[model samples]
Target: MKNLINYTVVLLLLVFSGCSEDLESVKYDDINPSIFPSSEADVQAIVASAYYPLRGSYGNGIHSTSENGLMFILDATTEILQGPYGVQQEASLHSYKASSTSFTRFYDVFYNKISNMTLSIDRIEKSNVNEQIKKKAIAEVRCARGLLAYELFDLYGPIVVAPLEVLKNPLDEQPLARLSNAEMVSFIENDLKAAAAELKSPAETPYGRFSNGLARMVLIRLYLHEKRWAEVEEQATAIMDMNYYGLEENYAGLWDITAPVSSKEVIWAVPADYAGTSENQWQLMVLPNNFPGRGGYGTIQSSWKFYDSFESTDIRKMALIAEFTGTDGVTYNRANPANYMQLGPIPLKIHPDAARTTALTTVDMIIYRYADVLLSRAEALVNKTGTPTQAAIDLVNIVRRRAKISEIELVNYATLAKFNEMILLERSHEYWCENGQYRSDLIRHGKFTEHAIDLNGAASQSEPYKALFPFSLAKISEGKGKFIQNQGYN
Candidate 1:
């Protein structure tokens, strides 16, 4: 008997039912209050469900892995897209137009995931769940909800439509509408604060549900985006004060997939068990020169420019890429004087699977880390000072010391512009692939357009409004007329 629980099962879990169930019955059917306790076990299951969206291939649609990689592609903007690294295909929609199908797909996916989270929160809350467990579940739900809003706010603008927008406005159907950027930020920040108050400490979450510290980390990020330097500093400092999570003695350990959870600094991620064909490592992006029926999708590669940017001595440069000696006996160092699109020295941060070379490893993708919190605090401080204060410099140096880069590279961090440059460099090196925050790093650092034009190898002009994408047509069609499409797209 073939096990039917595969990608189809994962799909059913996210969207529909296990068998031939009626659609209305499935949506309205609530979790049995008597069955689910507010115990750690029940909360564990709900937390697992929230993370499901980040691990799947819905193109950043709900919260799964595929959408996340796609999110990274979009976040990198044209810079990562063009550098012969990442999803750099010249014809790749993300590389050129701001309103490509990739954008549309992302728009739809985000809204759907938001709805899924809403369902999870509503059903779980009404259950006979434990008080603390319920609080944690709701907190995690809010964090997940804020994450969707932030991503959409970063890409589109704000929420405009009513509840119906979640149903009908997913495609190129009808009207589109969005709120101002400020409105989106305000919503995200308020929600994050709510999440923080409700969440417990990391020690309380045996299953890695997010905590108050994680909420604060995101709050710091949001405040930084809004240039609320004082608040960024305050929230970040408070989180750092908790002293629950701090820099490891070795920065390399931070990237160690095999390390115990204690060695890890991750704030949130998608969990993939050995359950299905799709829920595994992101090996599809790396590996080169087809080896023994090996599936190296090779969809994403690092660029020459990024490789060049890393100082030859930096450990990060080595950590990000690898030269492969193919099973064919010839080593590919881009030494083949023939192949124009060189695949050498590309990212190998993740291999297909170490435990089972034939199997795809179910590794969690890191989204937020403790280092990000410290950096956010440093950023707030430096922005106000126009130069990194000694405290800020020390915070950064603490990060670099673990990378083994030494005072030569890190001690050079001084002046404000130089500090900003160093921060961006660290972000690119530290969080690039895993966090998919490269594009946000560029934009917040004021490099979105300049770097985008450079990556495309063209000086094409883009409107300031193009920064936020338009709402999906599916949203408007559901409204039947009230919703309005974003300005540039129409």
Candidate 2:
């Protein structure tokens, strides 16, 4: 069944040809919506198609146009990850212009996902499937749409809210304008809330489907970004009280394809197969060029500063490989920091699998996990109380303890500002490269610009507007002047 779900998602993606073009241009004339999705299996298939676009972000060799993948655009701009020269380096250096092609491709992929989900929702609504199944299918589609909208907001600031109606009537020429940030947030919240009520709990949800817990996780992040402390605390607390999730005992085992499903830690994960069928390209992008198996392109390397941040006792540091036994069975040590250009530390967070090579590994990309929930709760509590509560300190300690690091005392962070800083640092170590959370985490903590300036030296402190990406010229043109680029990029 798991294989079927993965195979179905891949098949649907092919059947739709990834739907990269404008929704208006997508020729739906061949199929009658009136008779489509006429059965339970049909409705489920449409719902399954909605999940296919998530593969777009990591370049499943089908949907994503840019070889660099969306994760590069998201993580390269942060302090910890550095990419080889060009747009990736520019992204890391914060030197990217409005015309940056990689960012533009990433922007397109996201909108394409939203467009696909919108059409799925429309078809599900018109289908004559059993009422309960139809409603559940719609809920699942909205959950995907809501999460993608949240990602767009995180990347591009404010965007048109899905525009399902506009997409439904492609002939209408009135251009869609970007919504206000508040409006966008509200729209995302509405979708997530509605989905959360109708979706199954984590325990009951099928392996690949979105669950109620996943929707709440998205809400927790949204509230955190909005600085709505009370809401963050409320949402985080609800997830914690569910008592159905907990941190994986071994930090490194979480990425093992065999372990992710059985682990209590994972809230929601994008499933993949290690036999080289359904795969994630992150390992291929980040592994050192000289290492074993299918030698990676050496595109993404960890920054020295990030390597230095880890304490000696931290078990999580094992995930960051400075040395490895290659496929030739020879030990290779990383070059000196001065020679980092040729041989630097590469992140093995998505550990290489012995069974297969060629950049396709079965490691499931984890979207939300219990450890993040605990950290979010800790941050929310500190923000809401203006001081670190014992409960907040305890939550932080739980994650720290799992990492084999010393527990942080509340007294060490006497001020709310100091406590918040510690929380952000803990997150940097705990969640680096697990879905683009580090980038958003830095922005939320107001450290993004400062970190970029410190690391790249080429970045200017005055360019705080780089926090939000510029609207691609194509997107603006699509809107016919209704879409304005972010202020500074203009």
Candidate 3:
């Protein structure tokens, strides 16, 4: 009576089917048994494990419920999010070192999953599963690997990615070197290209899975970072031509508890539930312990500088709580902050879950959405043309209209630099705590360290070379002589 429709349950079945009752009969010298891809159903289970790295758990996933979430760390380092805690302040002030545990944790956790995807793809291709099934499975896993690779590359330049043949040998003690920058870019580009060819289109793709549009969106991001203007334009335009995505009518409703997983605006979102399959604990991070109806840990807050930058009528700021009356019957605001509200305003990025509940909410963790595409294309157009164009201005207007803010004028952003500055601000306002790319946006514009110093003063310890974080001493030691640490770190 067991159902195989759920891939997580099938993963358990796959594991147990390969296990032996008598442990002594198993050979230690043998590689772990590959018991997958004999059927189309098995391929689904195999790829499901690849999706685990993208979940909203703690350390195991990128969109984690805690401070370990990549977006949380990325935004905390920028002007978007801040707090008085050691790690949060260290991130905000740019005082973290190679020894900092938070910056060091990502490489090992995600690189191993990339290796697992390599093994899964190898197995799926070798098995007798339908050719169509094998193609889709490999594409899904590759998209996952490509996305994970992009995240690690963004954080730490290049990373050690073992080949399938090397992954096939479990007994070998190989210490691999990180790929060169060009090599790393090509590696990610190839995976995404292959995946885009085989994955379903946005309308055809199921609720939480990767679509061809998502693959192209990640490619656009990579191209943007590398300043490959033409390529960025090409990819962003391709997603737009799909005609399947748009701006959600309500900017804040996208994060509402009743938000649909199938929203046309969302390209890729982590389908979260209260059952702990995937979690969203942002409310718990920003809401104060004495918040009226629902209290939280009072861990972090949005900066006043960021709050003041928004136009008074901007609807996006509705999600940010500048004042609130606590359960203690005392109102807290920026001028007279209580113990919990000292840093700034609460960045309640998502709506408060009114239903009786724990810290976790059912609101989906939106990783990539169409608003990003529209804004990214606008940046690309201006950068590609070397001047602001009306075409680009219209794209920005689409997102602005949804924000209920007035449209910006094309003439206002005449030069390339001026247009990019506006695009960066719009991107920050649109994606602040959602995707965490604001740090990269700042770094891309050469404003990351400057912004840190401008906000935090001398305590920032902001350095030019510190743009890419340092590789931990432990990671360097583990690589033996083959690994080279990032610059500006021991």
Candidate 4:
């Protein structure tokens, strides 16, 4: 939160100094409290603004996926994989993101985005904004805002239970008023419900705004986190009930560059134009050398442990990597798939367009999907009942089956603990780098700290909390300390 306060100031300065040229094209100033959405074109522009921030994310368009990366660390602790996150020599993870400039930059990015949202809301509320358009924009903003707050909670602990417009202090020495797990879940649920109610139906937005499907996805997430088994099942089942979403017929093709347009598997996606849009540059995860058809610096390389986790029958193992050495064109050293995922096995979750051609091809990323919904339900069911029923088994097996391990027969009740482990395993494999949201899953399973590598390179010594970031020091200085930081770290 301190970082956000600081960044908010910097962002305000930037906004004051010069505005996004893109906004100029939209006649942004025309979007006033007194006169917005007077016409269809204006409404469309407001809808377009909804897609902002997501693609134009901060840090020079580099998304650290602090949530995703942190989750990777958590998964590593569970023997999920030894080195996928920071196992490499250069995966610069810091003890306190508050200490890192990158973390600060992301914090600022969030506020800048919220600022834009505020503007949108102000314009719509003050002007003759299109009713339909206003509904869409408001729903999208609330959903996006809720998502950001939820994400912050995922990172820092939920010590501060106030809204985003307000700020908190990390340095405050007083005992914190943190939200309990159930309370935190309630917060997320209320926001999602508001979004779900006000947002358009699925047919209202063909991925244009926050739709019923998206709300269902968020609800499923909330229910899963709250350990509300029946609710999780209902939400997941609701999504599956929709005709617009499901697992793509081809599992490997699900990540194909054209898959976003080709399949409905994607529940939420960050659409891209590659040239016209913010670069889908995450290829840096495994963009090796010349012989490769893709482009990226290959930073978040795969680990040998991750590779070894795949059963021999798992086709996802093969889909996740390419082993052939392009000796004639480029060379990459052979790295172990498990502990030594040294950029050896690239993330197959997203494939770049071979043509590098049109805007439509470099589709936006998928943030939510049907598979995740099922896995979340599987988690909830297992948590509620020690033994996973056939339905739970089917949920787990269906994903594995899609990965070409069709004969996977669910077995063993060994213990409730063992079953939870299995649910997490399903998440690790099914989600992995796909959604960049797996870290929360690890935290929820209480495995995040068990596997965390602190500054001393030892597992964390503190009790695991919500992992929410504390208020930025800047916020505290600005008198935003109605809130407080989590227990351990400031």
Candidate 5:
């Protein structure tokens, strides 16, 4: 399977490298509509091409400025992560300019991936493959497209939902218009619902591929973001009912390089390795600069406030490294508050495994996990009922017990607002570096701007419009005034 993935990548590169000026022009080459994807293997290879974009590769033309890809862009803007002076700093400080390279790279790369998926779906539908296989494959591709669209919507608000019909017609030069937020949510939900119906359960599919659980997970997230409490509860409950996934017995082991397949907690993840073939670039971002061979750039560090939030007995604190024993057996503690810039507590969640060198750890990038599903269910239940219930408390307790924290009782949270606060805090600790969820979680809780002001010491005046990132100046120019700059940016 690994060999097949590698082969498909090489085949795509060769085919794409021979194309004309644009990706659409590649359709006229030897790999044209008339000659492409004649068999199931060919269709599968095209689907594999869709997966590459999730890693932030958009073929020859689009390039990501951040080494860690889209994940860095998503995370760097949040309060939990502190970075050295550059794009990461710019993001954390909320000082994003229209010309920022990070914004342009993310905007271009994501849309490019969406276009690639649209083309792949078109080719798959037109192929001579078995009907069942074609339907399933298309469902998978649509789900991938929906996920990408959701990320774009989360960052930039409404965006053009480019389908195959729109992308394939090069001669039709009409301006693309952004969907309303409600319309966009409906669009993504429709795709995910179709996908969930066709996808195999997590236990039945290959470890890294999307599954019924993953599709539902995405829906649950979408509903949560929309504050559709009942739908979030329904989707989360459905995933829990599958009984195929659960929390890993050891919290820290979930991030171990060698335990990718063994960790039952992970619902969906990108297959990756330390080798150049499908590498996990995050390993190179979080490690401290002084570590042995393959020392990381130390681009991101955990804030002292984030570190201090964890209870002393909570085993999840293991994810943060406050001190380390050096190769020479010398002990080193985290830097003092005044010197945190030079040395701060490292996010050791994706650190090197004990059995492997820092440069060779193959920790897969996890997307959805069971613990998140449980928390989402709990939050949804509380919000739906307008108060906490026994079921909700029990669900929260389940995750808390696994983290070795004391379970909360009904009396602990006097109001629904208090319980919701607890859930948001738990999410922050559990999912700190796991794909930049903190930003959305903050927004969902209505505390994004407030928290940013407190954390970054920004202006006390609330600027709710800043919650949505501005469309890159380059993207707006490309749209020829069709794209409206997000409010407050202009």
Candidate 6:
């Protein structure tokens, strides 16, 4: 799949050269609708362009494990991450403003891609290609569009989505309004549902490409966000019925350098390499600058509170580093305060690439996995029943058992509120640095601001209105007073 990605990238470049002029009178090899997307590979190149922004490049991909990526930006706003830098500190304390580029950049990057994907899908559907190929190709683009839309919507509510007709007429000066909550939900839901119907199973899909399971997983997340318990249950169960996925026996092996591409546990992961379009530089971002065997800038850390939340026997905590020997022959720990230890334990969720000579590593960036499917179903079941169900507890226990922790008896969480609390904590521990959905989980449960205030006291700028991030001032200005900033922000 990685090699196929490289080929598609080269094809994309060859097909769409920005330097070209005279589109109508271009050479035979030049990109003309009649000349390009003329074959299956051409259709792939068109679809690949939509997938480009998902690569692990800083300020480019939503899946990037780097600070600029959606994972870091979203996770920084939760208990899983803490740092003393500009955006990191702001996100950690819920002090971000509309102008904070870290939060606003996603809108600028992905909103345009939605339009591009829409255009790509339209072209693929109108092409004279094989109907079956067109169906799958169009489905791929829709899945990418839906995934990107859901991501942006999760960060900021109800994004401004131009209609396909409006997109086709790019020169028109039609200013579109942000979709209503219902419209946005329906729009994203429709795209994902369509994609899921046509997309292949995980076993049939090329690694890193969207699969039916991935599309359904996004639906599950969307359903969870909307508190649509029944839909979440249905979507999760659908993935389970596929019977192609399950939990990996070893939790830590999920992120091994030579990650198991066929690991049934992984529903979707970005195929990465030291030298590839997708880069995984997590170790460089979190490792202390002077660590014994390796080197890193030591940027982000997980709070000691979060680390302490895990049971001592939890195998998941093995990834969080609390102590390390510096090159100066001094061991840095919480007791012996150091620059890195001051914030908290290093959230080295991804294993350190010991053989790496630079920041990049080949660890595949996991986006969604089967464990999430289990937890989502458990949470949805409890929410749907409005009480702790034995089945829900069993599902939660499945994940806990993998974490090497004692199972919580149903008697312990008899109330709906109590079960939700337990499930939220379980999600935080189970999915800390993976995809940053934990922030959404916290917000959905109305604990986002509460947890910040509880942990940081007066320092926390968290407010109930901060449940949704603010739109950029520029976006508002572009709206010419039509777009209202999120409540509470100026």
TM-score of each: 0.79, 0.89, 0.93, 0.76, 0.88, 0.93
Kindly report the root-mean-square deviation of model 3 from the true structure over all alpha carbons.
6.0
The digit string of per-residue lDDT tens for model 1 on 180-266 reads: 677678778876899999887765643334678778877877786677888999998888777677766755544454523554466
Residue 399 shift from truth in candidate 6, angstroms: 0.8
Q: What is the C-alpha RMSD of each candidate to the true structure, in Å?
A: 6.8, 5.9, 6.0, 6.5, 6.0, 5.6
Number of the candidate with higher TM-score, 5 or 6: 6
lDDT of 6 at 183: 96
lDDT for each residue of candidate 3 in 243-303, tens digit (9 for 90 to 100): 8898878788888887566689998887676656467888788788888878889888888
The alpha-carbon lDDT assigned to residue 368 of candidate 1 equals 74
Per-residue lDDT tens digits for candidate 5, residues 188-212, read 8987998899988877776667678
For residues 234-268, could you state the per-residue lDDT of candidate 6 as single tens digits?
99999999999999988999988876677898888
Instruction: State the lDDT of candidate 2 residue by residue for 111-189, as single tens digits.
Output: 6567667777877788777788888889988998898888878888888654666666555546668889889899899
Which whole-number lDDT from 0 to 100 does residue 410 have in model 2? Answer: 78
Model 6: per-residue Cα lDDT at residue 36 = 60
Number of the candidate with higher lDDT, 2 or 5: 2
TM for candidate 3 is 0.93
TM-score of 5: 0.88
* Rank ordering of all candidates by lDDT, starting from the highest: 6, 3, 2, 5, 1, 4
**lDDT leader:** 6
Greater-lDDT candidate between 3 and 6: 6
- What lDDT score is found at residue 69 in candidate 6? 89
lDDT of 4 by residue, 345-390 (tens): 6554566564554322343455677889777777777677666666
Give the worst 10-residue stretch by lDDT in candidate 2. Answer: 1-10
**Model 6: residues with Cα > 4 Å off, grouped in runs:** 1-30
**Structural RMSD, model 1:** 6.8
Give the CA lDDT, 0 to 100, for residue 81 in model 4: 29
